[model samples]
Target chain A: MMHSRAPVNAVIMPRMTEAVVDVRELRKTFRVSEREEGLGATLRSFVSRHRKDVNAVAGITFRIEAGEVVGFLGPNGAGKTTTLKMLSGLLHPTAGEARVLEYVPWRRENAYLKSMTLLMGNRTQLVWDIPAADSFRVLQEIYRIPEEQFRATVKELTELLELGELVHKPVRNLSLGERMKVEFAAGLIHSPRVAFLDEPTIGLDISMQSRIRRFVAEYNRRNGATILLTSHYMDDVVALCKRVIVIHRGRLLYDGPLADLAERMAPYKIITATLHDGAASSADLDAYGTVVSREEGRVTIRVDRHVAPERTARLVNDLGDRLADISVEDPPIEEVIDRVFTSEQTTVSA
Target chain B: MIRIYRALLVAQIQAASQYRVQSILWMLFAVIRPVIFLAAWVAVARSQGGQIGAYDVRDFAAYYICLSLVINLVTSWNAYEFEFEVRMGRFSPKLLRPLHPIHYSVVENVVWKLTTIIPLGIILVFLALTFDARFRTTPAHILLFVPSVVLAAALSFLSSWVLATLAFWTTRVHAITTLWDRAGFIFAGQIAPLALLPGPLQAISLALPFGYVLGVPAEILRGGVSVSTALVLMGGQVFWVVVFYVALQRVWSVGVRQYSAVGA
Candidate 1:
């Protein structure tokens, strides 16, 4: 909401034209029944149960255009999954308006369902005892995908995900990564125009995660499908999403480009300098800036971003021959996100 | 729509074939109960010196054999499956599909019957030969039996589906299902032919839907009921089908609202 990236919003925001996904003041409250842990309490619950309302989503608004891949990042239990459920027609909203492809998702009309897909990392929709190939055939019938279209999509997904013999084996027989690949393939068999992917790369090895990410990116590129992805791994969001919407405690804290978020939340840059062995003052590196680390003639400093250039110049001049190699870089996006969550003023008026 | 249903049914059949051992055990289990009842009734008839309430040993054999077949064809385990899947959170995926989740259970029920049909037929022939039971089948009765069986399947499924939706409210519906099964067993003539029951119980059986599901079809197959009686029974089956179908629709709307309010 800040002026930091306000100009970028103009290019991304869909106006009167129908956005692929539009959500406004969406809310979902769950009435969780509570019970005491004792025989007497259990008996009492049978007569009169205690219940409390927990608001999972508290009036959040966002819109996504066609072919846009937006990163939806939040801490654990921050309502990311719950919000996705509402958008995908799995859970109805307690209040607020949500439309996907101009259709109210909770109605779950066949046309709405055929046009979108939701892939939750923790849930497996494939039948465990049967081969995934058979499950794909079932999906084909469910989505009513023509035989040739289904076959072509499967072939392309198989090649992209490197799924050779994995589809033919029982899902239980496959490893976690293998099963995840099949789940991805099943979600894409219909070539849905909009996809809600929650933690799609969860539990995969690093290489497999990158492969899956690449596949998602390629799928979006080919189909111009709109996607909203949620992940705990910053690498996924950082690599795949230029724009990110961060929410905390069921509230939208920030929505802007990743670079703008890093700049706004994290005002500091990391400066690493290779110091001369003889002239290096190891014990008091903080005198120059906040000492991040000092090891093997290398001294890292955390300095204000705006003053990084001046600070580096002064350090080089003051150290003279003592500084061997010096470099300044922005803090990692993960650290910036950590700072954003810890900051007291999360809702920056933009 | 027909192609989708066919694919669903075929998938379930193939999926069931994977559990070959369980399927065989299920077939054996289905036969064991009726065979035990047949033995007990035959012993009782022998002790009674000829017949009890107009049912001789051969009559009891024919009755039990037909009861087994009717029960197998009509009964559905949708309630049990729904209970398990709801608890496991597996029902959510079914909801995401464009089709209704009940289709999965219906197809599963049909596939199970198809898989066990050969064994059920073998058991029927074995019972007829071993007990020297006169398995007479009239052309009219056979023709009537087909629709009766199909209607019975629909009635059972709709009734059980109504009970299955109870999972949306509470996890435990075993007691409900058990009471239903026992009621059907006692009143629907699965334990004994309707004619063998007391006069009052026979009237109750005729009035209730359970009798239409199992006892009526079994009677038609046994060649005892008249054509007019068969028509009345068929009418009763259709009546119950309409009643349960409406009940199922009403229950489903309320249950899905509950499920959506809570997470499925």
Candidate 2:
């Protein structure tokens, strides 16, 4: 669907005219080059270098209203992280415009900077030698957080992130997950209005991942902090974001509700049958739709939602004695995504 | 900003504390490099009957002893570290703060040098006793020395701001910083007093800001300063500050533009 701003501008009044984050037709290009090997080519390349321009992010624009939690989704090298950096004012864009809280992001004004935070996974933002709490004290000084507000935010985040005991331990001694939790707490001490998370759960165990995911969700719910979260982990996107923007090859491939994209990818059903007497030499379920997998006593196949009943009935009639059990379900989200990525110009659901 | 400076210094202390052995070893290396120079220069002076350019072996010992102490105190390698940070993408966090990253760097450099000061002072005391070094000073010069030392440190830091931003457009800033670093030693009079250099070399020394930062204040601390010499030196100090201050504006803008263009 077309992402238009005319309606968004018309509906809002003249007085309450603040968006926490906004972007339009943003682009970033890199002058990357072919790697020359050996002394000969390297010497020759210096005289007249061969260069290729990589469009890291090409004309993808979307706005996050105040307190909106939007998931940025794409495969590897899809420019989600690049886009986040541009919005956070770490990098400037080659074309188009972006604004955060009514200030130009690239200008990186102190006031605009004070109102935002950016967190990247696998990066150390805390002082590594000191106790996590002491690093927080350093942040308190840097951000000029008033004692009262600093204490309240620290206490709230510590409790929510379960950092009570971990706070006292040196950052070097803490586990990766523990350090990440403290990092988040330190980031929020200033009470920034916007937060950018780049792969926040890239290398955490299942339990730790949930702890971080829960902390992120709870923090947003309580504080109404506008968040743009980028994670390859589909679970993070599914659990936290109602709306997701997907980019492929630096282009906006999808931008809408998560459920809508999933619905569009896999609009049919897959049925798995367990048989008692079906000892066929081979399995050929393609007449119905497509066979996904087959075993000795079980076979799974996908069928159009409207034709599922007919397909199920035929399977039962053909192997009534062997039909021990049968089940029907929608395709997995991963599979739907795989199909979307594999084919283009298919009958995508609106 | 002062409050932030204090905390940044304390935080760097805590961070460096993790590598306690490395710090001690570095201190040891610091001692060896200067003492070796002191011994060699002193030997050369004594061979010439205890005199080289108005400095006897004792004077040489004292000059280098003080040089060793102050060089470590004012020199900041944070610019090279900043270059690394930009290349590795760690600069994003620094830029996200409400204050310019340079403020943090400036604070940390001051703090880091001060933290190392105690250990360095101990070495200085040992050298003074070993070499019969003299550190005579008047209260007036002592008062002036404080601001001079602070200005020297600021000048040293601001010059690096340009070096650090070189990473925005090119690789090998570490090499570039090292090249300039050696320039500081040769021209800033870190190795020899500006007066001892040949006329042309002395001209080169005075023309560059490095001498104002390291050599000039250093001479001031040695306590034979006339009022005019002190004024001229401090005036030269202010000139360097204004020069580097303007350089930072150009460097920062281009650096940020380069960063965005590359989508870093």
Candidate 3:
């Protein structure tokens, strides 16, 4: 199973633009020590321990053009974080190559580091006991930002994030959302050309998540920075990213525009009809398409994407006045991505 | 680089100032071991008819008093702190920064010393007056002691940083740091003056970097060594500083590679 590598569905970039972040077959394999749960085994293992090679990031490849906000989508342990770490220069790849802004990431040169930023939602660089503004000053010095530029950037971030007095409070005293806003501001203080954001909205309330999503979109618009964002929240991806790269089990499963993902993976659409006087039953809907659900007076069915309009028209004509309300829509992005992973499994097993 | 260091120093000082009471308590706690050693040595000297190997009660008082201050000035807890940072994944953010993470540690150490210095100085003065300790120091010895203490601080910090880099390879650095502190306790003349140790042990202490970290500086401050001897010891301190610095750089490069390969 460890050696069962999946083929990559590479995304082709336009020839007119140079890729800001380029990766080719980037991989990272880790040797992990293993031990069984037993005192005798533990005692014996002290003398001769066992280890296994686990490929956290199998040979996967993709590219992002400048000013593009691309979603890096994958489930847990799908090597999404590993690939981001490699691209951000926090982890070295065991093989293959990656370059950000034409600099080899693993070299970790000052110029390269200065031009990029990686923000992990669960981690923070702010000093816990002090006000976040103090930490920003330290970062200003570390990045050697001039006084005028530093003040201007801070003012801009404060206005954009709505962090008026929050920056003055000790970081430990601030709420998680407020702290994250400051973390984002601190990361952007240098105005990096490339940003890798890992789960930026992992545990925020819905309203806060919307605010952050908007901030990211606006930041990208203003700076023209290339952003690679990963989030389990499908809303973030659907709202902010026009294109997405989906990886599964250390392999690139699909990479294309977010709109095309459902067409390619699901190739189906959903149609819902609210009938009057409970006129249509599940049995009646099955004739039109696959009955997805029948709750109360409404019936939902799945049909081929190309036949969705025909299915809807037939339902309206057959039911006539009984069809009080009707609508046809594409499947949710989450369901499409789930099918992508499950179908890939079927293909691999076959 | 200077701007970065200054900024880091200001930030660390501000953070440390918030815990002034805790800092004072920790500094007082550090005085305990030296005070115990001082009492024991003074007792031993009194029992041995007011003198034992050139150290009378007053001399023991002066020696241990200076030893306490010197140890406090040069001590670094970075090995333990680094281990915790690595285990908790706190080091990852530091790695992402353009500056080396060691600069943070270095600045934190300096701030810790700065915050504790005035209080520790008062404690040292009180001990000196309480014990009626007399110093036999010349102007020349005082001048040389300045450089000796500075060199000692550099050597001690670099050595601790070198040990701290081991955290990249192993999460459990407690045992290693424990062993290091134990060796430093004996060989750095924390428990006793290096001159009073057995011939073989004294030679071993001199051969190790620990002696230069605390022992030699304390001895110099107490006016126990000649000017030429002090210069020679300073040279040794310089050599160990260079050695530890080179070792730190080499170990850090290798350790970061290991970290990047295996991850935090």
The numbered model that scores best in DockQ is 2
lDDT of each residue in B89-187, candidate 2, tens digit only: 667777788767887787667656656778888878888899997655567767776778778887888888888888778844888888998898789
> Candidate 3 residues B50-126, lDDT tens each?
89898899999999999999888889889888888887778888888889998898899889988998989998999
Task: Score candidate 3 by lDDT.
Answer: 0.88
User: What tens-digit string does per-residue lDDT give for candidate 3 at A59-133?
Assistant: 887888899999999989889888988898888789999989999987889898889999988887899889999
TM-score of chain A of each: 0.89, 0.83, 0.95
Worst-scoring 10-residue span by lDDT in model 1 chain B:
B255-264
TM-score of 1: 0.91
CAPRI grade, predicted model 1? medium
Question: What docking tier does model 2 reach?
Answer: medium
**Model 2: lDDT of residue B32:** 78
For candidate 3 chain A, the 10 contiguous residues with the lowest summed lDDT are: A1-10
lDDT of 2 by residue, A1-350 (tens): 22322221111212336667777889888787686689999888888888989888878767777987888877787788888888888788889898888888878888888888888887877776789888888888878899999999998998899887999888889888888998888888898889999899989999999989998899899999999999978888878888777776676777667777756656789898877755372265567678777787677888887888899899878766767999987777667666665543232222
